[model samples]
Target: MSEAFTKSMARNIFFGGSLFFFLVFVGLTIHTTRELPERDHRENINEMVVLGKKVWEDNNCIGCHTLLGEGAYFAPELGNVYTRFGNSKEAIKGFIMSRPVNGIPGRRSMPQFNLTEEELEGIAEFLKWTSEVNTANWPPNIQG
Candidate 1:
C-alpha cells in the first residue's frame, strides 16, 4: 500500500465506522423489542393503580420518599412498601390513615393527607402494583 493519505481512505473509514455503529444500534433495538413482551408489566395497571399514581404525584410523595430508586431518600423506599408492610393493602391503608393531620411534635412524621377511602385504596393498589415490578433485586434488601 502507498504511504500517502487520500480522501478516499478517509471517506471509507468514516462510512465503515458509521455502518458498524448503525448495525449495532439496529441489533440492540431488535433484541429489546423481542424481549419487551416478557417485560410487558402493564398487566398490573388498573384504574385503582392509575388513580394511586395520581395521588402519589399530587401529594408530592417523591419529595420525601424514593420509588424504584428515584426521588429523595429522606424517607423509606416505597417501591417495596407493599411487601415490606406484609403484603397487606389494609395495613398500608391503615398506616396512611393513622397519621396525624398536622404531624406530631418533635418527630419527623408523615402528615395526614385526608384521602378518601377510595383514594386511600387506590394509593394502596398503586403501591401494590409497584411492589410487584421486577427491579432486578433493587434496593438490595428486604427493608426497601
Candidate 2:
C-alpha cells in the first residue's frame, strides 16, 4: 500500500525471485537424472555399433550430415536413416556406396568415399544404432 519506493522492497523482490528460480532448477535437475535411464533406448552394445561410430568420425560424416539434430544440415538427417532405409543395415550401406565420386551435376549429391566393405558396414551399423537412440521424435518427420 506504500506509494514510496524503498530499498527493502527491491531487495526482497530480488531475493524472492532468485530463490524461486533456484528451487526450480534443483527440482528439474533431480527429475532429469531420475528419468534419464528410463528414457534410454539403447538395446545392446554391439561391436559393430562402436566400429561404425569410429568410421563415421573418421570420415567426418557430421561435416555434412546431422545426427540427432547435431552437425551440418547441408545433407539429410541421418538420425533415423536406418528406419528410413527399412531397418536394413545392408540397404543403408548400399545407398552410401552407390553415390558418385565428386557428385553429379544438377543434383545435390554425396561423394563416394570408396570405403571398404567392413567400413561401410560399420557406418551402417552406427547409423542403425543412432536411429535406435531416444531423441524424443526429433526431425518431426520420417524423411530424416
Candidate 3:
C-alpha cells in the first residue's frame, strides 16, 4: 500500500527536519565551545594587542592585507608574518615604518599611515599576537 501525501505528513516532515537540524546545531556549538580554549589563546590578549587591533581597524588595513586567511587578497597574508620575519617584531615595524607615502613608481605598494611610535608598537604587538594563533598552517608559504 502506498502512503497518502497529506498536510499532516508535510508538517511531520518539517518538524522532524527542524528538530534534527536543531540538535545538530547544538552539538556543533558544544564541540566548538570545547575546542575554543585550545585554539583561541585568549589569555595572551593584552592592551597592546587591543590597541593594535584598533589601529588595524581604524586604518582599514584589512582592505589590503589578509590576516589568518581573512581579508582582501590584494597584499599578503600576515598570519605567519612573525615567523616569516625571523621571529622579529622589529622587522615588521621597520617594514611598516619604511613605506613611502606616495608608494613606489610602477608598482602597487603599501601606503604610509604615518603611525606614531606608540601605534607602531601596538600594531607590532598585535601582529605578534595574531601570529601566535593556531591557523593549522595557512598562507601556504613562508614569505606571506
lDDT of each: 0.89, 0.85, 0.88
TM-scores vs. true structure, each candidate? 0.77, 0.87, 0.81
lDDT of 3 by residue, 10-70 (tens): 8999999999999999999999889888886989999999999999999999998889878
lDDT of 2 at 130: 80
- Candidate No. with top TM-score: 2
Which tens-of-lDDT digit does each residue in 95-140 have in candidate 2?
8888864545676888889899988888887887788777688879
* Candidate with the greatest lDDT versus the true structure: 1
lDDT of 1 by residue, 1-144 (tens): 566768899899999999999999999999988876656487779999999999999999999999988999788899999999999999999999988646457767788899999999999999998888766777788797
Q: Which stretches of candidate 3 lie over 4 Å from their true place?
A: 1-14, 101-106
User: Candidate 2 versus the native: TM-score?
Assistant: 0.87
Better of 1 and 3 by lDDT: 1
In model 1, the Cα lDDT at residue 77 comes to 90
| Ten contiguous residues with the weakest lDDT in model 2 | 36-45
Q: Best to worst by TM-score, what's the order? A: 2, 3, 1
Clash pairs, candidate 2, are: none
RMSD each, Å: 3.3, 2.1, 2.7
